[model samples]
Target chain A: MVETGLKLCLKQDHPIKLDINLRCQNNEILALVGPSGGGKSTVLRAIAGLYPIQQGYISCQQELWLDTVNTINRPTHQRAVGLVFQNYALFPHCSAQENVAMSLGHLPKNKRLQQAIILLEKVHLKGLEQRYPRQLSGGQQQRVAVARALAREPKILLLDEPFSAVDQVTRRRLYKELIQLRDSLAMPIILVTHDLDEANLLADRLCLLYHGVSLQSGTPMEVVTSPATAQVAKLMNQQNIFVGKIVAHQPKKNISLLSWHDRLIEVGYQSGYDLGERLCWMIPETDVILHRRYQVSKGERENPFSGIIIDYMLLGGYVSVLIEIDKKRKMKLTMSVPLHVARRNGLKKGIVITVTLLTKGIHLMPFESLR
Target chain B: MDWESLLLSIKLSTLTVIFLLPVGIILGRYLAYRQFYGKSLLQALLAIPLVLPPTVLGYYLLVFLGQSSSLGRGLEALFGQTLVFSFEGLVIASIIFNLPFAIQPMQRAFESIPREIREAGACCGLSPIKVLLKIELPLAWTGIISAMVMTFAHTLGEFGVVLMVGGNIPGETRTIAIAIYDRVQAFDNQAAATMSAFLLIFSVIAISFTYLVTERHKKYYG
Candidate 1:
């Protein structure tokens, strides 16, 4: 029963409980993104057959790796999985070539070393093949681990925070290498990480998890901007999550009216919710457009509001400004603008500013307490 | 020194180490990685030989393998011989007495390996036996060697258990330690001194070799 993808549905309540359902097509990269202790790594371990689930059905390429009802479970080595651990657990006593060669046991003995050398070169570690894990730098050791994992030419690849140990610069370089490598790999790849930015940059789709429960799975931007629930919104770092009521839906104008405290915001058509229904809504910081102080702009005409700057922080080239829109409600909105734009507008604490929330970016979710 | 007794001691120590090597590895790895019911109790029971008087352990072994017990009688029926007062009996007692010496260092070594290394081995498609041979055994060799040395040295010097279970039979159970005691009992101080000095030197060399190898391994791999 050989197919071309992976499907894993697992449920367990004891001993590191988790509920996860995930799928990946051939050549797809799915990122399991969540907070620490959110069972992202556990999911990877389960897929790799290192962790046992009390009840589950796991199949790779339509071959059953685990089926609890039938009492069929394959041991880790029998499953065609290549897993890169967070610590890059390269054999300390083995050289980089030996580490990669260890995984090439399926090949002829004489060809193992040549294949390992090729894999090491693929990871840009050709000259360092003789170095032991202890002798290599963290980044080099990580590359050796990746080479070792890929040496098996496994049916699936699992990466558990593969870039977390390296410095930021090295991490960026590894991310680029992995992205380049993915094009050559036809197997499904699942990555576990707490870094949303890493997922956004490297993964084709992101699966959001919280406390071992998968909340949503979608493209990076969709999950970030149109989270299915408040929890997903919070997990995505959407700072503008708020509870609002659908005051009206104007079908003729293809618009909806959302009442946030004393304000009426014009949003894109949301057809499902009844009038006066309470719902959770969020707007991404990218969708909050800062109005030019010196000159008015046409983009400012949609969902325009004035607020006073409560806080502002410069992050690299962008300035994140938190503005309080309602003094009595203590409601605030966060927006990011380039540093040059902030400076030109004289943005600072206690300064009054006007911003427009894009009508299409006001995403709505079913009512849930923002606890 | 009684060359016959010294040779007997060497044979006994070598046999004990041979038998305990696999036992120590299997038990040590089990203790290192698993959690189960009665695990602590099993560990405490295994450690009794380290703290309890050798005579106490010997008394139990003597009774368990003596002629009056069913196990001893069954063994005698099967082999047409008694186990007590024999070289085989002495080896068994020595192995039991050196259990901690044979297992603790290896257990600590196995524990020192991070869990992810073994998982990585599995993920790399190495079978469990291959992982143990290519990954765990190489990493834990220092502790395994230490265990062997400690077990050999301890088996060579055991006195009370040998006396109780093997009954001072010359050329059979009269180890170097018992021979030293016998020489002293016979008012032969010079002979006792010779055997005692030999054992002292052998022990020093064995312990020093273990320490040197362990220190070198740590420096190279720590």
Candidate 2:
């Protein structure tokens, strides 16, 4: 396992403060996801000893790489951490095999080349060992960079937006190769990326960072389904968020009544919420169900409401429907429906439809946690 | 024509380049990558030779290495020789005069190497010095070669500084420029023309070699 806790203050035109703690076990992929300049890359750099931390400890497999409190900071080369840069920083002058051999510094020159060839074969670059970085395709260069990094025999691997520079087709292939490589080498991997879809596809755990602070970290499902804060829900692309007041709480029944826009909305029970306390809640677009106004029975529709479909977006197999609720205040909710479902229901703009917001789909957070 | 003067010019230029190369690489790499409080001022000082008149620079060196100066006296105590009006003095003056030519290009070459490449080298478990030798220097070969050639060519054409510090003393200090001037003063235009043509051809060859190397470097790496 690799563990890191670091705090860094970068004094640029505007200062950035970073405080984060993370852990990754063997055979686990921990993805750091955030907006640009949110210290996602800085966390990886700190773990690799590229960025010095003000105070923290970093250890991998019982080896102490950094302990700032005791003034123990190993140099980057001395630490057994491999970092694959976004740009694939291969030596432009060195061929693929030579680049990999460069990492095998302890071996004799002949043995180094032999080992580098073995590693290159592992990355599926056997015949192209003599090609320079300029002669290699983007995907091939990235594979060579990975081979070079792995030649160091590091305890953990840090990939910094490894696939951002590749095309979609090549990216899919690289993803498959990366999974195979990860399986063969059971080391902890930390991937830094801004693409949420990529994180969801590859990572075992996700850490969401904002303005240098980690807002939430958990399995991808937990982070998407049960966000810790409203900001995290927004980061996860949850669109339907509203502020409501708890009108009443029925503790024995495990339900509550929330007053939102002249309507009482029934939601799952939440304790420690005082009566009339303001709260923010979100509902994922996928959990929203739409039915023909005449079809949904009155008793089956939990929180059904009729609204005009103001806009709709078609995305291949799915359609996003935007509805303007019929209330004195302006409130719009977005819901996703399968293309077949949308077609069957004749969902279109200007059409009045009924949407049920399921009780289990409404996730609430304290109003004070908005920031 | 004075053949010994031509040979002396070649020897002095060659020895000066050999001495300046290592010094230039170290200083160039340091200046390229380091940041300090007075970094701009230090860079300006290093560039003074590129703009300052050679005679003015030579005069300053003359004063700094004269018998009355402490450094001059210390050297005299150590080697039992005065610095002025000697071949050694010409070497010193040439080194100071051609320093910027050697260092600026080397610095530019070192700077042209991407930082990620160097960081990757370091991440490969190679030390900083090894990274410089194996990765940085090879990648910057064009700049290093250009610097050496320019310094050699600049030193070969030295006249003002050589005359100011090491007066025309036959084989010891009478370089090609000085020899050509003497021939012209004595109304031997034929010998002077021959010497000037030879010097011109030598310079053309050195500059052409530099251009050829740099062009090949660009094509190979681009």
Candidate 3:
């Protein structure tokens, strides 16, 4: 059996080019998370066959939707795909029952109403069947939209920011309903949204898009904890990204040497690579341990570095110190020092500090372009 | 009592509306959604009758279709008929005269509908025709209805074209507008006022009710 990929590389020059390349799993929900105007919705629209593309192919469950080379573009209805639009474009004149029933035009009339009612009931919109779109509130209308899309029993469900407008309580309830569907339906779900929290809650794998390109695509943890690129790191809201250079590929010793400014450090790398390659390294906030003085430690995997705190911010529970290292080029690190230690030591903006970065906590992704 | 002319004018307007409504909708929908060459010229041409003196249009109709011409002969021979001083002739003239009234509102309505909505319909596997039937037509019904009524009412009040080409027949080409003029010229104010009053009251009530129905949809649908 062959795999079907939802692929796109189009630029009507409509804001963003919407270049996405992903093969959705049969049953897993693939959530796309990004900032506003980062082209999250553009990718969703392209997959739905709404946006015209340039030189791309899309196939779902091995069925070809679009093949630019072959000039094959299946009409959207023929695609049998479902979508719960952002605005829930419910037919205003029709009641919820009739609206759901509209999706079942291919079904027999007797079965259409019954099927529509069942789908509506699945979305918890049973009693509101006779109500028109105007009569429904924002959240209620969103549920109806989902029901109508599912009424078709489509091959894949594409939701374009469905819960963006709903209240938090209603959004939570909606997520529960979606989670139930996740366990039951083998139909792949692709939800596009700008909210990271929504992605964390809904997506098994998160795909991030930025300015018409797939910045990163991986499980939520992989993208957040150990992002692959600087763009991915920025999109994931990582505070500290410092430039480092590879020093030694000590394979026998199981420790790769990296130089952070003038200080030499040893960190773990899954593979040994060439030397002098410029790399971007990340020190997660949880990794940095603050100290009262410029202390030295030996016989430990933790590497120590010294710098004066250029700026300090008192967060709720942690103190963030912005440290500048004197290298040939300026290097800044956002080291989150716990507040308890700060209070005990009375650390200030001009205070000289020593911080230890654990070998395990250091993430290294090669930035080849920077060199 | 020139009741036949009055009745004929009402029939003419009614028939014109019936034929022109769909034509207007198709034209409007196409123009609003699709961009092609000479669009501005075509739109201006469609609205020509609204601005041009009806007498000029009537004369042009006669020039191309008068009995003496080969074109007129060809039409007469092809259909065993002529389109001058005939009821069919007046109907044709009225359709052309009131074309813009049927088209403008419908175009505005189609323009107002979001293209994303059409794309949404298309993504649901609705073909262009299906999108038009399901999404475009129903949504644009208010403007369509307004177009029909306005065109029909405008045709009802037409005079100059019928006078130039119609020759005031008793029960055929002589419409109410022509009859009013004829009554006024003959110094028959009573009959003229009677026709005028009927025309005024009927048009006012019809237009008022059309506005009411259209406005009701706007208020309730949103």
The global C-alpha lDDT for each of the candidates, from Candidate 1 onward, is 0.91, 0.86, 0.80
TM-score of candidate 2 to 2 decimals: 0.94
**Which 10-residue window in model 2 chain A sums to the lowest lDDT?**
A5-14
Docking class of predicted structure 2: medium
Write down the TM-score for model 3.
0.86
TM-score of chain A of each: 0.97, 0.90, 0.81
**Candidate 3 DockQ vs. native:** 0.50
- Over 4 Å off in model 1, which ranges? none
Q: Please, what are the lDDT tens digits per residue for candidate 2 over residues B1-222?
A: 789999999999999999999989998998888878998887889899888888998899889988979998887777689888889888988898888899999998888888888889988998888998899999988999999999988888889999999999998988999999999999999999999999899899989999998889878776
lDDT of 3 by residue, A1-371 (tens): 56743443454455456666776786788988877887777677767777668767888877888888899988777887888899888877678988888788778879988888888888888789999988998889998888888777788888999998889888998899898987887778999988886888889898887877778888887888789877677778777777888988777878898887777877886474568888888867667766546344452336866677788898778888887655346666677767887777778888777777788788888674432
Ranking by lDDT: 1, 2, 3
Off by over 4 Å in 2: A1-15, A292-300, A315-317, A326-328, A368-371
In angstroms and one decimal each, the interface RMSD of every candidate reads 0.9, 0.9, 1.8
Interface root-mean-square deviation, candidate 1? 0.9
Q: Compared with the true structure, what per-residue lDDT tens digits does model 2 show for residues A168-215?
A: 999999988877877887688888999998999999899998887888
| Candidate with better TM-score, 1 vs 2 | 1
The residue-by-residue lDDT of candidate 1 on A1-371, one tens digit each, is 45678899999998877888988988889999988998998898888888889999999987899999999999999898888899999999899999999999899999999999999998888798899898999899888988899899898888999998999899989898888878889989999888888999999998998888989999998999889888899989889999999999999999999999989999988899999999999999989999999998889879998999999999889999999998799789999999999999999999899999999889999999888
lDDT of 3 by residue, B14-120 (tens): 89999998899889988998889999999999989878998999898887778888988887787688888888888887888888998888998899787767776
